[model samples]
Target: MFAIAVRFDLHDTAAAERFDELVALTVPGIRAEEPGTLVYTPHQVRDEPLARLFYEVYRDEQAHAAHEARPATAAFLEQVRGLTRQLRVELLADLPS
Candidate 1:
């Protein structure tokens, strides 16, 4: 599977919540629209409340590319433009399950 691991540091706790709200909307839309999206999970760090993590798994590079091209993704990016910092994204190769 092709995966992406993402981490974000929000400007504040409030921004984290706002960003999560944006994700809530985006994730469901992706699930409904993209059959190749296998997993899309968002997590909040317990030790650092302002930190957000996302684990996304797709069928292949094409699936991942399709996800990035979605309108929901675009809207989500626009929504969080100023709410985050120290954002990191890692493209991963999943081990055999």
Candidate 2:
């Protein structure tokens, strides 16, 4: 599996609101259309009202590439750039079990 975590520091309350709206619009597509998207979850940050985080897992690198290739994913990335003051993306590596 391939995993990634994204942190969004939204510009303000308005940006956060817009970001949430975008998420609502975008996730349904991800859920319905993305078979290789094993898990995709968004979270509101504790004590940071303007912060949002996303956890995403894919079946493999090809799956992740397919997700990125989607038009909705492109649109989501474009819209979120305006809302976010800072965006941090981490490519996660698994630890030995």
Candidate 3:
């Protein structure tokens, strides 16, 4: 799997709310269109009112590329541009199972 975890620090609580809403809007398209996207989940960080987290898992590198190439993904990126203060993205690797 090609996976990633992202931590988004919103500019303020209000921005967090807007960001969450945008995430809700964006997810359905991902669910319906992204067959290779095994999981794409968003979380409100505990005790951090202005923080959001996302965990995304794709079938492979090509799947990740396809997801990023979508117009909806571009729109979502544009929508969230000013809402976040900072974002940290970590590319994840599978562990021995």
Candidate 4:
């Protein structure tokens, strides 16, 4: 398995709304529609209103790449571009189970 982790900071006031939108709308759609997506989880830090994290898992690198190429992902990115502040993405190798 491969993992894709992303961390970002959003505007404090928009944090809750953004997290809600992602969980209620974005995450479900991605998990159901993207075949390569094994898992998609988004989280927000309780103490830091602006902090957000995304933990995604896929079968492999090819699967991960395909997920990134999906139209829904593109649309989501476009929709959230303005809502996010600082973004950082990291590709990781999953440890043996």
Candidate 5:
């Protein structure tokens, strides 16, 4: 499986609200419409208002690429650009189960 981990830092409560809005509004669409997506989850650090994480899983590299190409993903990216302070993305190969 292929995985994507995104860590984001928000500058303030407002930024965090925007982050939350994007995740809630966009993720379901990605999961429902993208066949290649195996898992899609958004998380916030416990009691930490400024930190956010996204955990994504796909069947393989092709699937991962497909997810990246989806319109919903693009929209989500564009929407969140100014709403975040710092964002980091990491791609990983899943360990054997």
Candidate 6:
């Protein structure tokens, strides 16, 4: 499986609501369109109010590539452009079970 863990700090707490709204729109669209997407989970950090995280898992490299090519992905990226103070993403390869 292929996965990615994304973490970010927002520019301000006020941006959190807009961020949530975009995620809500983006996740459902991805789920419906991408059969190879195994998981797409979004989290809001409780203690760090402006922090957000997303854990995404795909069936394989091709699946992940396809996901990035989706329109929803572009829209989501655009929405986050000015809202984040810091952003980091880690691409992952799951170890054998």
RMSD of each: 1.6, 0.6, 0.9, 2.1, 1.6, 1.3
Candidate 4 global TM-score: 0.83
- Report the Cα lDDT for candidate 2: 0.96
Q: Evaluated with lDDT, which candidate comes out highest?
A: 2
**Whole-model lDDT for model 3 versus the true structure?**
0.92
Rank by lDDT, highest first: 2, 3, 6, 1, 5, 4
Q: Which pairs clash in the backbone of model 6?
A: none
Flag regions of model 2 displaced more than 4 Å: none
Backbone clashes, candidate 3? 0
Candidate 5, number of clashes: 0
lDDT of each: 0.88, 0.96, 0.92, 0.79, 0.86, 0.89
lDDT of 6 at 76: 88
Better candidate by lDDT, 3 or 6: 3
Question: What is the alpha-carbon lDDT for the whole of candidate 1?
Answer: 0.88
State every prediction's TM-score relative to the real structure.
Answer: 0.91, 0.97, 0.95, 0.83, 0.89, 0.92
Clashes of 6: 0
Clashing pairs in 5: none
Q: Candidate 5 on 5-77: residue-level lDDT in tens?
A: 9998888999889889888899888888878889988999888879998898988889989888988888988
lDDT of 1 by residue, 1-97 (tens): 7999999999987898899888877788888899999998889878999998899999998999999998878888888979997889998875789
What is the Å distance of residue 6 in model 3 from its true position?
A: 1.2
Clashing pairs in 4: none
Model 1 deviation from the true structure expressed as Cα RMSD, one decimal place: 1.6
Q: If both were scored by lDDT, which would come out higher, candidate 2 or candidate 3? A: 2
Per-residue accuracy of model 4 over 1-97 as CA lDDT, tens digit each: 7898898778667665875575578788787787878888888777887788889898888998888788877887777777778889998875789
Q: Pick the candidate with the highest TM-score.
A: 2
- Mind giving the per-residue lDDT tens digits that candidate 6 earns over 6-93? 9978988679888988888888889899999999899988898899999999999899999999877987898898898889999987
What ranges in model 5 sit over 4 Å off? Answer: 95-97
Angstrom error of the Cα, residue 48, model 2: value is: 0.7
- Displacement of residue 45 (Cα, Å) in model 5 is 1.3
Let me know the TM-score candidate 2 reaches against the reference structure.
Answer: 0.97
